[model samples]
Target: MTSIKIDRSACQGYGNCVLALASVFDVDGEGLVVLRRDTVEPGELDGLRRAAYDCPTDSITFVA
Candidate 1:
């Protein structure tokens, strides 16, 4: 499984992560990005990486 981490302090609530990986990331009512799953399936890793790369703040980290 792949693990994902997000630095809340660095996050800008831009929703880019959510848009890129809706199954793994979600935007709360306040527009903050939230991790829906800690462990990602192998098939989802590509989307997760895309989301992490899309983050303008570069707050997302992946641990494989």
Candidate 2:
């Protein structure tokens, strides 16, 4: 199983991750990243990785 993590302190609210994978990520009212889930589905891994890379603050990370 893969696990997704977001460093809230490091998040810049850029919304790149949310754009990349809205099902897995979203922006709260304050515009910070809100993780929809921690465990990544097998099919979502690629998109999740892309989201992680797209984050300007490098707040997204994963354990596979």
Candidate 3:
């Protein structure tokens, strides 16, 4: 199993991560990025990677 991490302070609410992996990322009412879950399924890595790559602020990260 893999783990996901986010830097809330560095997040800019661009929503790129949510667009890439909505199951794992979401936008709060404050327009900040929030993690729906921290653990990543093996099949979800591609989406997770995509979300991380799409994050303009580099707020999304993972440990595999």
Candidate 4:
């Protein structure tokens, strides 16, 4: 399965990733990006890519 990775140190927590894909990304109470799940479903690949692309800090990446 393809999975996602995030660099916590590089994440700016702009919430764009979350906005782009709520099922895959979330914002914690402290305003940080949280990965709800690492693995991606084939149907959700577009959403995953959108989330990664929308990340303001470019902190999200795919590990296929």
Candidate 5:
């Protein structure tokens, strides 16, 4: 199992994370990143990595 973390302060509202995985990431009204879901299942690892990799600000990280 895995979990995700978001550093809102580091988020630039690029929405790349959302684009990579909308089921786990969202954009708030303030244009900050929000978590739709934090837990990452084994099958979701690829999408998780994509979201983390796509984040230019590196606001999202995963813990296993």
Candidate 6:
């Protein structure tokens, strides 16, 4: 399974990840991006990667 990790300290609440992969990520009421699903579904790998890469602070990490 692919695992997703986010560094809250480095996150700027840009919501890029949420917009890129709503299934695995979302912006909470505070506007901070949250990982709704830590493990990526098989078909969602691409979107997850895109979200991680799109993060301006590079706060997202993927582990296989």
Give TM per candidate. Answer: 0.91, 0.95, 0.96, 0.89, 0.94, 0.91
Model 3 C-alpha lDDT per residue in residues 1-64, reported as the tens digit of each score: 9999999999988999999999999999989999999988999999999999999999988999
In model 6, the clashing pairs are none
| CA-RMSD of model 2 | 0.7
Query: Candidate 1 — what's its lDDT?
Result: 0.88
Better of 3 and 5 by TM-score: 3
Best model number under lDDT? 3
Kindly indicate the candidate among 5 and 6 with the higher TM-score: 5
Tens digits of lDDT, candidate 4, 1-64:
7889988888877999878889888888878888899898888888888888877788999976
Q: Higher-TM-score candidate among 3 and 4?
A: 3
Writing each residue's lDDT as its tens digit, candidate 1 over 1-64 gives: 9988888888889999988889989877877778888879999988888999899999899998
Please report, in order, the local distance difference test score of every candidate based on alpha carbons. 0.88, 0.92, 0.93, 0.86, 0.92, 0.88
Tally clashing residue pairs in candidate 3.
0
Segments in model 1 whose C-alpha atoms lie over 4 Å from true places: none
Worst lDDT 10-window in candidate 5? 36-45
Clashing pairs in 3: none
Give the candidate order by descending TM-score: 3, 2, 5, 1, 6, 4
Candidate 1 versus truth, CA RMSD in Å, comes to 0.9
> For residues 1-64, what per-residue lDDT tens digits would candidate 6 score against the true structure?
8998988888889999988999888887778888887898778899988998899999999987
Q: Model 2, range 17-50, lDDT digits (tens) per residue?
A: 9889999999999899998888888899999999
Candidate 6 colliding pairs, count? 0
User: Cα deviation in Å at residue 2, candidate 2?
Assistant: 0.9
Q: What would the TM-score be for candidate 5 when compared with the true structure?
A: 0.94
Residues 1-64, model 5: lDDT tens digits: 8999999999999999889888889999999999988897898899989999989999998997
Q: How high a TM-score does candidate 6 get?
A: 0.91
Q: How many residue pairs clash per model?
A: 0, 0, 0, 0, 0, 0
- Judged by TM-score, which candidate is best? 3
